[model samples]
Target: MSLKGKRVIVVGGTSGIGLSTAKAFLEEGAQVVIASRSSAKLSEAKQTLGGNVETYELDFRSEENAASLFKKVGEFDHLVITAGEGAMGDFRELPVDQAQTAFNSKFWGQYMTVKAALPYLNKEGSISLTSGVYGKRPAKGASTLAAINSALEGLMRGLAVDLAPIRVNVVSPGIVDTPVYAGMPEEHRKSMFNAIASQLPVGRVAQPEDIAEAYVYLAKNGFTTGTVILIEGGALLS
Candidate 1:
């Protein structure tokens, strides 16, 4: 689908899935803006994206920053939220603050972004949030992530109906080979992903580009709203 002239904002676009999505939009002739808490990363992203791209510094955990970022963004045809925080620990062992951080980043951060952008969104504009396969299929040591992602999906569906003409949707991806996993212990990370990938019908983890198409589809399809597009390589098949 052609997105020529579309004004798009991609939060957390400095790296991972968000960065790839931003590039995809730019390639489609859309003017894109990328926001992140990291100025260094944002500057690098701006240089890489080159034309018709803008970068903003935002730490979504801060209410003031979230509000200010959207205010400065003014208006846009689509807003894509791919920023999230992750924690791995048993529910009982996990610190409350750790869980809160994840919730605040993914759930509340998304809420704040959407709330602030509502006034500036075009009549036919769309909002897309990132959830994940964990939201649907829970796993050990991932309770916090699962809960937050599930909540995000529910929020998007409810908002889609409440927002009406302004479409809202969730993109739930499976294991994606992004920088987000760079911090994990190498052996454990490899084993974990290998097991996860083996279970998927496709026998492979997703790439950022694989999931980016779903976001682009949801944005262009006016008739689709309150929907969750699964980019999981059939991981949920079982």
Candidate 2:
């Protein structure tokens, strides 16, 4: 289960949970490659990761771009996709176009990434995807988010069966303090985090590092497949 010298690729790894997951792999002595669509973010990640990893500018939404990415990478041991943005709003009022975009990025994007990466993946390797707690314990005004995450988990299960021996799994994390919420007003954001934290038994909101560990575990554990590891601080219980 030791990751030393293993080749791991993390798509959408420039910031937030993706960046933290890359750092965790590095700490375990793995050869890490981080990919993002933004070249500027990639540069920042390189510096943050202490310059020992490879960086690729990848737009996972496009099949061609994803294929090009793996072509450059050649072959890799594990593929982790923590990219994609989810939309949050009332189902009735939310714009249909925006919801479609969310699904395209978060659900279809990961799907394409997996398809592109499979050819270049080692037979013994694994694929870890990202999901969210809303997929299971949805809240009001987050119907679209729930659908996207739920679809991802379903996809993972099917993939595990179809691509046997090459483990496929997902990490379903609850609220985490990542840049994904940067668009909200500062005060409102803090207030929201505090409100959720109070309900959780953990008594604190999760950080990127907290969720990052789940990805690491999924990659290292060969026996675990078609699983959704919930690192949600007992959110469903609360």
Candidate 3:
């Protein structure tokens, strides 16, 4: 339950939900390790995290990279993967290569990390993967994202059974205010958030920290596994 002194590794931890999850784990007195593909972003995240955690450069798409990460980390108590690039566009217009890349990066990336970490992961440990609300309540142009998310949740369920005693779960967040949207023009981004907020019962989009808490809960709760904790501003309800 208590995370004090437990080791937690967060993949894709350089920004967005992953970074916030690292911060949250630190707050709970866990020993946190953050990994991502960008060294520069990892450096920035290390600084942002107050330089108290370990940083690893990991492109989970590479089996070697994933293997190297656990080798260097030795062993850890929890593995959280929040790194993924979603592909958006009408299914008809979406390029097959783009969809494949998205799947490789998000779905297979996490898969590879899990495979690499299993031997090094403590038997008491847990694994948390990221999904999205689109898997359940998809909209136009979200076909690829929906498929990827659904696959991840399915994987979680199977893994929980296969890796019994070592819990596996998912955090399926709705739209959150994170750097993933940094490329959007400021006005358009704000407008989009506002428009979505009006429909949600919560009256606002989620912050990365909001979703971060769910990850924390998953790590601390021993009885929960094979579950998808949706922190989506009630988007499915709306």
How far in Å is the alpha carbon of 50 misplaced in model 2? 1.2
RMSD of 1: 1.3
Cα RMSD of all models vs. native, in order, equals 1.3, 0.7, 0.6
Off by over 4 Å in 3: none
- Residue 121's lDDT within candidate 1 is 89
Model 1 ranges off by over 4 Å = none
Clashing pairs in 3: none
Give lDDT per model, in order.
Answer: 0.89, 0.94, 0.94
lDDT of 2 by residue, 44-146 (tens): 9999998789999998889999999999999889999999988889999999999999999999999999999999998899999999999999989889999
lDDT of 3 at 63: 94
Summarize candidate 3's per-residue lDDT along 90-171 as a digit string, tens digits.
9999999999999999899999999999999999989999999999999889999999999999999999999989999999
